[model samples]
Target: MGFWDWLTGRDTPPPAPVPEVDPAPTEGDILASLDGVDQLISGGALPAVVRSRAARVTRLVRQTLPRLGSLGLGSYDSYSVVATATDYLPEAIGAYLRLPRDWADSRPVENGKTPLLLLIDQLDLLGATMEKIYDAANSTDAAALITHGKFLQERFGHSPAADLNVPTPPSGNSPDPFDLERP
Candidate 1:
């Protein structure tokens, strides 16, 4: 808020209100929340990045429905993951939804990014979480993948190969060198 606006009692617009969530959110509940957010994004003007993330969230919701059906909607684990990933989406979007476009786009907070940019980044993270949930549901050989992942981690998770102390060949001329004739 500028000095004049503050003096005039015109404070900057407050953020959009976040939607409420159920205590134990189900797949349907999660999807409904996503649909609500999608509609909100569509109905109003939004930044390009926000629009893109909103579109992705909608697409993910569409893709998730069938997977949820196949994975067993009653499965607590799947429901938990979906709920965890999507439950906060509306609030994340809402944080900047009601702010004036000029303020959202131009005003920088303590992090040095405008509210619009921060919202985009937050949506990106949530979108990735949703994708991971989909991947977990669709995984064909999760056990195998996990085993391999652990193996790779054990093999390469440490310091560089030089730390292993494998002997290095002498760089300068040596008294005795490998000779094909002797062999």
Candidate 2:
């Protein structure tokens, strides 16, 4: 080492820590995670705002779950639903829950918002996203119903009623209302 470096007591740099990332959850995992989050939300003594928003996210996820097939198994919307359920919503709530209630609700952590406010904003975003995903999933069925109705109308809507000619009794000779003798 140089004299100046030695005098300065320079040392080896510290190693950078790697960020920990959770693996992407599967569809089944996503569903299970939603259930878990539901239990957490219901079981915990969270504020009304937190509980309500959490409910909205879980409800949307459940409503959209069965229709994910219609959205295409691996498509972006499907993936979004899964990620929100398994990652975003859970992580946001979990982080807020980890903090003490008074401090989380009162102390501004970032951008002039308390942890509670931050969490609410995050949950709101998640809820809105899930709402969109729900609508997209349901649109598949709605579109099919519309298409089928259109098909039915095309096949039957414009056809004329069949003409059945009932011969009127010989003009001015009609006698019997119920029955007439036939020659």
Error of 2 at 98 (Å): 1.4
lDDT by residue for model 1 (1-183), tens = 789998887876788999997576655776777778778778767877688897786677567666775466667646744654465667777778778879889999858999888888877876786687677667745767888878987998874565889998887865455665653
* lDDT for each residue of candidate 2 in 19-54, tens digit (9 for 90 to 100): 999776766787799988988899866898899999
lDDT of candidate 2 at residue 29, scale 0 to 100: 88
Model 2 TM-score relative to the real fold: 0.69
- Name the candidate that leads on TM-score: 2
State every prediction's TM-score relative to the real structure. 0.54, 0.69
The alpha-carbon lDDT assigned to residue 124 of candidate 2 equals 90
Runs in model 1 lying further than 4 Å from the true structure: 1-23, 68-81, 84-86, 141-183
- Highest lDDT: which candidate? 2
C-alpha lDDT score of every prediction, in listed order: 0.73, 0.86
